[model samples]
Target: MNLRVRVVHCACAGGRHWYADIDDADDPQPDDPFWFVDGCATQTQALETACGELLALSDRVVRGDWLPRVLEDA
Candidate 1:
């Protein structure tokens, strides 16, 4: 069960921003984390913030203290 997390970035009308998502390499239909980080002024800043958020979320998931939300329609 390999969980892969990645920081993705893009440019929008507001500015540059980044977000993170979790995926299971082994399972294709697993519950998607549907997690996203808030926008930042710079890509670097957004990525840094996203990394921290992802780490916290991942830790909680590991400890069975939290369940990732499924926000495909959100």
Candidate 2:
């Protein structure tokens, strides 16, 4: 289960990175684990949202086909 997160950040080009922070990853290399991204945010609200979403993404990645715990279907 590869849960890749596409984050919108300023320093994403070149060798710059903004990615996931999982403890276990596919490729072993010298890279910062971001859930799926990196970079500094200016707004608190956006940062909060990113943090929350990243957590969810992490759960989804590790849990495989497990249903989302944050919501219920009608």
Candidate 3:
């Protein structure tokens, strides 16, 4: 599976915040282990957090410890 991480920003009355989402590059979906990071005060912080999560996920995938939601459900 080709995984991609995306960072998004939002500005509201509460203030500015950032979020990150991890999904498949070709076909995205909401599934288990769908990593997310939110409420970051800065874009840099959100990107850093997303990078760390992506690295950890890659390690898990390499070690055969990661499972896609579809497989898990089956």
Best by lDDT: 3
Model 1: per-residue Cα lDDT over 1-74, one tens digit each: 35566666767797766655555557566456535555656667766765676677678778877454557546
Q: For residues 1-74, write the lDDT of model 2, one tens digit per residue.
A: 44333344455446443332332335465244433334434434445656676677667667774443222322
Q: In terms of lDDT, which candidate is stronger, 2 or 3?
A: 3
For candidate 3, list the clashing residue pairs, or say none.
none
lDDT (Cα) of model 1: 0.61
Q: What is the lDDT of residue 31 in candidate 3?
A: 48
CA lDDT, every model vs. true structure: 0.61, 0.45, 0.76
lDDT of 3 at 52: 92
Candidate ordering by TM-score (highest first): 3, 1, 2
What does candidate 3's lDDT look like per residue over 1-74, in tens digits? 77788888988887889978776777644544357777999999999998898888788888988545434645
Q: Which window of 10 residues has the lowest lDDT sum in candidate 2?
A: 65-74
C-alpha TM-scores of all predictions:
0.53, 0.33, 0.75
Question: How do these models rank on lDDT, best leading?
Answer: 3, 1, 2
TM-score of 1: 0.53
Off by over 4 Å in 2: 1-42, 65-74
All-Cα superposition RMSD per candidate: 3.8, 9.3, 3.8
C-alpha positional error of residue 34 in candidate 1 after TM-score superposition, expressed in Å: 3.7
